[model samples]
Structure formats: structure tokens, C-alpha cells
Target: MATFSSVGVGTGGLDSAALIKKMVDLEREPLAKLETQKAIVTTKISAFGQMKSLVSALSDAASKLTSVTGWNAVSTNSSDSKYVSATAVGGTLPTTFSVAVQSLAKAQSTASAALMPLGAAVGAGTVRLEVGRWSGTPESFTPGAGKAPVDIEVSASDKLSDIASKINGSGAGVTASILSDASGERLLLRSKVTGEEAGFRLSVMEGGDTDIGSAANTDASGLSRLVNGSTVTQSAADAKATVNGIAVSSGTNSFANTVSGVTFTAVQVTASPVEISVAKDTSAVSSNIDAFVSAYNAINQLINEATKFDTTTGKGALLQGDSTTIALQSALRSAVQSVTTGSSVFQRLADVGITQQRGGDLAVDKTKLAKAMNDNMEELKNMFRSTEGGSAEGIAVKIKATTTSLLSGDGFFKSKDNSLQLALKRNEADRVRGEARVDAFEKRLNARYSALDTQMSKLTALNAYVAQQVTTWNKSSG
Candidate 1:
């Protein structure tokens, strides 16, 4: 549990502890060198990990430029968003349309005539509910054709609250609630969905004596009284709109597929038409190019730093002179400089204002890029995402392929990482063996010193006793 700094006390007048330590230190010196080697390998591994991350980032940025949809994005502008707003997706052609909002869709609702107190009993009955649509001025309610009606049974002792609960739990397309006001208690019902097709009608069949459920005793009437025409509150209506003078109707405010790849949402009624236009989203393509340039520069910087030599310090970087790193840098530069042979006027990255500098980093000219995008958009697109393949392949595709190979399982980087890890393991094993040998040598030295100290102590005591005898004999003879 504890370790001693020295082995012996030197009681026999010899510094045996210091001698033992010197021997042990000499024997353990090789372990220290092995530790240094492990540290160097670990640093190399860390550097390689950083290299992989930078390359992966560049690959992700390049992938965005390989697909047509990535650059075919569109943007929408609505002159008046108060009444309607629109959005367009990729492949939506550039065009303009006029949108007019007439009316918003509404849900049907109804409230019963004033009944007795909240707890007052209503006669037992079977309430049947049907969902359908009603149209035309002074609307007429008709049960939906071919649709089954939901039937709910109530007991004679059921109170007004119990009736509402039963109707709510009947799985009908209507919701029921009890509303109490100065007039007393009433049942309020509303359709679960908006629009005319979601409208519903309720009819009741009383259970017992007609006296307790008669229309005359409206206060204690059966559920049938709730369906009277006078109780009708709000009527359902569909949303009406117009696009370029063409009438359009929807069951809800949100309309889709009415305009190709465009979704229109009606907010409120508008007196005048609002102009909606879809245009090519050139800004998005510019942003993608910017990202690619940024990522490419980052990888370039990392590779340069990892392989640079410092003349002042007379030392190179951690990965300096490494063949794998050198090869990767060369391949990336070659991929970028390679010409893309396509039908487009722009055949290379420089054609689009992306030029490589002397240090192997890319720079962008915003003005040139914008002009190219405007004048030769189709040709520019083909230069970056052509499907011809081979030597005519786009720069992005080429770079992506190169990075993918370098980071693969059996790739250069992976092989180097495997070798470094193996070296570290071997160094650790050597350290362990060296430490074991040092410990065994120290134990042997301690044991030998302990035996020598005992023998010298015995001899010193015996010499003192013989000297005392000789001195006494000399004194007596004098």
C-alpha cells in the first residue's frame, strides 16, 4: 500500500540505499523513452482526426451542388399578405397571379331553448344525430344521404348535464356542452369540423308518458325540443376565393395544389386582389456557392498547417513528410483544377468566378458570379451539375468522389490511423514489461543490501570485544 524512497538506513556505515536507487533508475530509463514515443503517436492520431473532419465538411458542401433541385429553388412575393399568403417550392415556374378572398369557411353551431335548472331531470329518449350539408338562401337541413346516424339512449332520471355527457360520448361528429345564463340552462352543440359538409341535425324519440316530455312542458321537455328550428345558431359555409378571375372553393382556409407547387392560405376577406408572384431563387444558389467556398478553404488551411515546415524552429508539423497527407492534398488540388467538359459556356470553377489562389485556397468574385448567374443560368447550372459524367463531370462531383475515397475504410487515412494505434499499443506493452523488470531488480538489490548490513554489524561488534580484551591485558602487565 506504501512505497519507500530508499531501501536501507546505512547503519553499517555504507550508503546502500543510494546505491540501490541508482541501479533501479538506470534499469527503468528505457520505460521513459517508450512513454515519449507513445505521446508522439497519440499526437499524430489527433491530427489525423482533425484532417478527417475538415474533409468531411468539404464533402457535405460539395454534395449540395450536385443536384438540380438544390439550385432550382423558388421564392414567392405577395403584394398584400393581410388576406392571403403564398409559398412556392422547387420547380415552380416564375409567374404572377391575382388572388381574391371573398369569404372564410365557418362551422355550424346551435344552442337549445332555456330548460330547467342544471340538475333538472329530462325524460328518457333516443337521440339520433346525422351529418350533412345545407346550401341556398334560407337554408334547408337535409340528413346526409347514405350516412348512418349516431343514436344515443338516455334514462328517465338523467339530468340536463347527463344528457350532454351522453351525446358527447356517442361518437357522433358533434360536441355538446351545457351553457347557463340569466334565462337558465341550455345545451350548446357545434360541429367538430368546419364547412357545410360537416353540418349535423339531431332528432329525439321520447321513452315514457308523453306528459313529462310534451312540447307544452318545454321546461322539462325531452331532447326533441333541442332540435327546433328556432334553436339554429350559426350556419356552415365553404371558403370562396378567386385566382386570376377563376372561382375556387375549399372546405378550409388552407388551399394547396390549386396552383402548381404553390400553397395559398386565405387570412381574411380582401376588397382588391393581391398579386402573388413566383420567381427563381437565385439568392439560395449563391448561398450554396458561398458555403462550398468556405468549406473548401477550411480544408485547404488544415492541410497546409498539418504539412508545413517551420524554418526558424528547424522542425516540421506533426504530419509533415507524411505520404498519405501529401497525396490527399495533391488529389484535392487536381480535382478542383480539372476542366469540366460540358455544353455550358462555363466549363470550370473559374468560369463562375471561383478562382484558386497561389496558396491553394479558393476565392470568389461576387460581381462576376452574379453576372454569370443572370446571363447564363442554364449553362452555369450544367457546369456545376452536368449528368454527362466522365471528364465532363462537375467539379463538385469530382471533389466529393475524391474525399469519399480518402475517408473510406481501407483508405489512406484509415490505414495510417490503424498503424499509429498499433504502435501505441506496442509501446504500452514495452513500458509494462520494462516496469516489471525494474521492480524485480529493485527487490533483489534490497534483499542483498539487507543481508550485507546484518553481516557487517556482527563483525564490528566482534572486533570491539577483542580490542577491549587486548587493552585490559596491556594495563595489567604494566
Candidate 2:
């Protein structure tokens, strides 16, 4: 065999770095395309989520509209016809209502006499008097003992009434009043509060002739007994006071009681305007029905958009013609049809002026609707507003239940959204993984190319060195 020179053997470089570089570059296109597709899916999913939230709110509002039974409202107006009046039975309860009530009373005890200043006494000489509670200064006055309290006054203007008033106002734990009955206007004194410990006591200074009741030398403790014999000793002015025939523990006072499931609040005087009414709010049912219809329409639109696909454009519908969409559409249509076998008022949709056109869409017949609203409003209300025990008693209930189910958690929209979200997440993960592979492959290819270029340059330099040496040897030998 002929000898093959090392130059020829080493001429063809063993490096495939350039080929690897070209392969890695070609691989990047598929990964980039996948990333773009994933981004598009993410945008579509986010939009669908927002739409789902709005639809859910509309559905909840519809359910509330359908279930309303009575209007609970308050009005401060005095002349408004809606005001509920108190019952005729002594205390106030709403008109057309009966309330069981028991009356109560408050009273005072242990106080037999009123504190009198010595100035009211009939003594020939003046005696100083002080009337005030403990821990306070007394208001001083002078009196002449044993006479009409008015005649014994230290001043021309002062009388029994004036002295009683001053003593009562002294914060001495008693109240004073004028009892102008058949017995004449007597200065009546009573305790401010109804308790044995709260009764008033007084001291008379420098006058042995004064007794509390005499007006003569009406001593500090002169009024020792009640004016009347109806005992437990109430002030004479409070003789008629009684609460449900239960004797007051002491003196007369207003009281409140909650008895026999009725609340009775007594005031010193009756002041609040009594109210009574017996009419239902008729517009509430109609408003509820209208709200339900609007919400149903909203959900219908959402379903239609989600499941429909464009045949000409080859694009999937937003929710595109899915089973959930079809079911919702059918259920809503049936509910609006208003089938009632027993009720003459709501036997069909046409009765209520709801018409289904040839395009499979509902249209409101305003003229017929107005007639139905005016003539058979009660029947219409019964058809949609009445429900019992969690079951659809009417068209309105059925529609509300179904709409709520579809929009709430674990419902059609939620279930589908979860699926789509999972799909999007997986797609993005795959795209990212593919990109990473592409990057690593490219880096390896470039490193190989650099190594190959360095090796080739060294080989070429060695070949030049051998050629130069050969030329020098031939020249010397010749």
C-alpha cells in the first residue's frame, strides 16, 4: 500500500461543532412557538375568570329577589298611612295585634313626716331653723311658733307653700307638692324616692313648742301620719295609684313590667303618638320578579357566549356551545314558560305577556304585561314569590335555584374554570421546560465550536512548521 501522508490524514477536522450549532438553533423555533401559545391561553383564562365573578354576583341578587316574602320597613312619618298603631289595651302594640300585659308600680316606705323649718311655727318668739342633707350647708330660717304657718312667717311674702318649697329644694331627700282637692290645697310633702332608707328626718332648734304637723309650732317631725287611712302611707295626692291591683310597697310611683309575653313600659306621663296600620306593601313582589328576570337574562347571555363557536372563523366559542350552556338555556326557557295546572292566573307565559319568538329569544309584550300586572297582580306574585321547605313551589323558585347552582362553587362555571386553569398551567410549564432544553443545547454547541476552531488553528500552524523545515534541509543538502 502506498504511504498516506499525515497532512492528508489530519486535513479533515474531526470536530462537528458547526453542525451541532446549526441543530441547536433549529430547535429553538418549536419552543418559542409553544411559549407564544401558552401566553394566549393565559389571557383568555383571565378574562373568563372576571366574567365568571360578575355573573356570580348577578345570580346571588336574583336568588334574593325570588325569596322575598314580606317587607320589613320603618318610617318616622306621623301622617304616613304605613304607620303601625298601638292596640286599644292601655299600652301600645301594633294595630291588628294582641299583647298580654301586666301593670307594675313603684313605692316608698318608712317616711312618716316631712321636714319643716322652724320659721313656719306659731311661737311668739323667733326660732332659727336649718334644713339640708348631711355633708351640706343648711338654709337658715326663723319662725314664730303655734299659729297658721302663713301668719308665723318671718317675712310678709313667705307662707307655708314657700317654706315647703324651700325645704323640698334643700336636697333633704323629700319632694313637696300642693294637694288642691276637696280637702283644700294643703302643702303635701313626700319622699323623693320610694325606699325606707331614703326617708327624710329633721331637727328643730330652740323651740319646744313647735310640732311638725301643727303649723302652730310645727316641729321638724310634725307630719307623722299619712292624710288618708289607705295605709302603707302614700302621699295624700297619690291616693288612686295602683298597678294591676298589687299594693305598692310604699308611696305612689310609675313602674314597668314584661309579663305574659308582653312588654309594658310605664312613664310618669303618656306622651308618644300611638300608631296602627293593616296594609301590605304590594309593589315589593313585582320588584322582586323583575329583578329575577334581569338576573336570569344575564346568566343566559354568559352561557351563550361561553359555549358558542364560530363556524366560519374556526375559533372556539368563549364558553363555546358546551353542555352546561345548553342545559342552562333549556332550564331558563322552561321556567319562564309559567306552567301552572291548578292556578288560572299563571297557566302559561302568554298570560303574563312573555312571548317566545321564532329566533328562540324571549320578547316582552308590553300591552299584555301591563294588563296582567293590573288585573292579576296577586296571582303573578304567588307564581314566583311563594316557596316552602327548600323546594320550588313555583316558577320563580325553580329558576332561582338552578341559576344559583350554576354560578356558585362546584357549579358549572367553577368546575370548568378549574379545568381550564390546570390545562394552562401545564402548558406554560411545558413551554418553559422546552425553552430551558433549547438554551442548554445551544450553549453546548457553541462551546464545541470554539474548541474545534482552536484545535484546527493549532493543526494548521504545525503543518506550516514542517513545510518550512523541509525547505531548509533541501537547500542545505543541494
Candidate 3:
């Protein structure tokens, strides 16, 4: 851009500002071309960046198949899932066994006599809760180790509802609520866990004057009335089950450690033995293969779009005719199609039902792959896992190594990006220099035009003096 404030005003009637602007624009032509070139290069760099990300993602997916031990997957099934459900927690040999659930675990529950109104005041005292196992018909008391009793205080004006709230808020190992019927309202207590050892006992002592009850902490009045008159609605119980005719018991319905690497949960007592089976997880292996295919397809798609050329439009993609991009596309295709060079039970990806499609993407054959994973498991593992020597490495190992190097420092992508960045820097420098030249040109034009204006003014003054002299002579002569 250029501007001239006092150009062509004296000597000529020309649009000097417009002329200066045109000249400056001509001078800036090179800078505009430079900007266009920089934009193209920057676009190329961004495309390469996306390609690198996809290759790195492919590497991650490949790495999962490089370890042989990681493929030790197993699936478990239960014949009667309604009664018992089984799961494989760790690695174990494939086997089948019978489970007979004799009884499910049950929590202990107790209820007070339904004789008090909803708001009827009950005597108050310090009620202590002792948690432990309850056994035998006589029900002798034994304190659980490391469990200190929790004591709660009650006032004379407190109703059964208030006691229930206090019990719930005390953090005791039991839940309390009030149940109402036509007869009256009764307080109900249940153990927090469904096991014999989760049972709790309640006793009351003197809290203050008039709220005191029997000194033995058991009587028919005060807070002790709840425990003394409460009936055991459900006794604490443990789950009982049999595995291969051997009896097994658990405090809860879940039986985790009965079998090595196996856990089963009982929902109901089985009429007969429920069979549980464990086997190699073929579906898991298939999923891993699918992940590998998906990652490879992503890389393939990016390269295809970036390098494609349209014949009808006479236009090419960003990476079209780029030697580096072509080489990358070729290398990835070769890696997938090439056979394993090292000691593998299976030689190539195709040997295990994975094959390249028309556009260089991989596709898995579900039925064939499942059979290979089931019957030829060891061979499939060896094909995907690496051997000690690099000469006989697995396909995954080779792809991992290649992708890792490409993403590393001093790789092709790094060098290309660095070169493009330098070009950008140079572009900016060239723009600065170009602008400076335009400024110098504008200055020169202003100087030349200023001198012409001064010269023209002097000539006009001299002409006026000459005209005045001629007019005086004519008048004198007349």
C-alpha cells in the first residue's frame, strides 16, 4: 500500500495516489506468491502430522499382540445362572465341575412386640449393642474379638421411633426401622450383612433418674422392654454348597475361593447340581485381532485420501506426487502382506484368517479365525508374538519397530516438519524485506514529484512577470 499527500498538484492533474498504489502492488506480487507457497507447505505438514498419529495408534494396537502370556484369557459358564453364576477370576485349566447349592445365606432379624402407639413414650436408658455370631439352640453369648460394644442413651420422653433413629445414626452394625399394622407400631432390627457372625445383641442400662430399668440390663420396662420381648424373626445363617460331593460353606452367598481361579455366587438353592464349565476365551482373541485390523484400516484410509489424484477434476491431493508419502504407503502394505521371517508357527497374517482388502486395508474372516484361535491357538500365538532373535520376529514386533522409528527424532516426518518450519520463517523474512523495498520506492516517488512541483511554481511566476512588462509597454504606446 502507498500514499502521496501532495503529488501532481502543480505540474500535472494526475491521480498520483492511485499511481503510487499500483506501483506498490506490483512490488508486492512476489510476497503474495510467497504467502501462497507457505500455506501449501503448512497444509502438507499438518497432513503428515495426522498420518504420524495414525501410525502411532497402529503401533499401540500391534504391541498388545506381542506378548504371549497376555493371551491367557478364559471364559466361564454356569448351567443354572438363576441359581448360581460362575466367573473366572484368573488363569486356570479348562474344566467342568458340579455345584449343589444347599442353602443361601440369610441375615438375622428381630422384632419388638407391637403394643406401643406410634408416638407413645417409652422409658430410656443406655442401650449397648454387642455384635458376634449366634449358634446352638440355647443361644449362649460369646463376645466377638476386637469388637467393642456401642452404647446409646434414651430419654423418658423418647418414643420407639426416636430410638430407631438414634440406633441408625450410631453407626452400629445393624439397621432399625418402625413397622406399623392395625395392632400398633413395632421396632424392627436386622443385621447389616447376611452371615451368622453379623448378628447383634441389644441390652439397656440406667441413663438417668426415672429412665433406669432392671440393673441386670434386662427387664419388662424401659428400653430393655424391646430386647426382652423381641422375637427372633430370622436366625443368622451362612451359605452352604457342595462341590463334587465335598461340603463348602461361606459367610455370604458368594463363594470365591472354593475353586482355583473360579468364583460363583448363589442366588437360589439348586434342585440338582448345576454344572459350571471353563474354557479358553476365543472371543477375546478375536476382539484383539479386530482391534489390529481397525487400526491398520485407519492408517490406510489417511494415506489413500492424502495421496489420491482426481483425473476428471485435474487436481491432486495434498500429498500427491510426494515421494515420502508414497514410500510410507508402500512400506505399510508390504509389512502386512509379507510373510514372517522368523520362527513362527504361522507364517503370515493370512495364515490366521486376516487378509488385505482392495484398498490395502485388512479384513478378518470370522469363522476361519475362530477355528484357528480354538484349534490352532499355540500356532496363532507364536505367529503374533516375537522370538528372541530379531531375524525371526513376529509381524507385530516388526510393525512396532518400524512405526516407533518413524515417530522418533530424526525420522522422515521430523525432518519434513523441520524443513517446512524453516521455509515458513524464511517466508516471513522475505515478506519483511519486500515491504521495506516498497517503502523505499514510495519515498523515491515522493522526492521526484516534490521537485517537479517546485520547478513548475517558479516557471509560472516568471511567466506572470513577463506578461506584466508587456502590458505596461502596450499602454504607454497607446
* Candidate whose lDDT is highest: 1
Candidate 2 weakest lDDT stretch, 10 residues: 82-91
Error of 3 at 424 (Å): 5.7
Give model 3's clash tally.
1
Regions of model 3 farther than 4 Å from truth: 1-12, 30-38, 67-70, 112-131, 141-173, 176-188, 203-215, 220-228, 309-315, 321-344, 356-359, 363-371, 404-478
Tell me the tens digit of each residue's lDDT in model 2 across 1-478.
1111223223564435445645875987887777777776676677566556655665565565454433221122122222211212222323332221122233332222332342343222232222222222452223223311321223334444664566555555556564444433344555555433233333232234454334443333332212222122441222122233333322223222322222223223322222223233344544544555566566566656666678899998654655655775676676666565433567565667766665345556667766776777656655555564243365556656666776778986688678778878888788778878887777766665556666776888898999999999999999
Tell me how far the alpha carbon of residue 43 in candidate 2 is from the true structure, in angstroms, after superposition: 3.9
Candidate 3 residue lDDT tens string, 46-129:
898898889988888887777554577789999889999998853678989999999999998999877555679877578778
Clashes of each: 0, 37, 1
For model 1, the superposed segments whose C-alpha errors exceed 4 Å read 1-10, 13-15, 112-116, 119-132, 136-178, 183-193, 200-232, 409-417
1 against 3, candidate with superior TM-score: 1
Better candidate number, 1 or 2, judged by lDDT? 1
Tens digits of per-residue lDDT for model 1 on 38-123?
88899989988988888898888888888778789999999988889999889899999999999998888989877766677877
TM-score of each: 0.83, 0.49, 0.76
Error of 1 at 281 (Å): 1.3
Pairs that clash in candidate 3: 342-392
**2 or 3, which is superior by lDDT?**
3
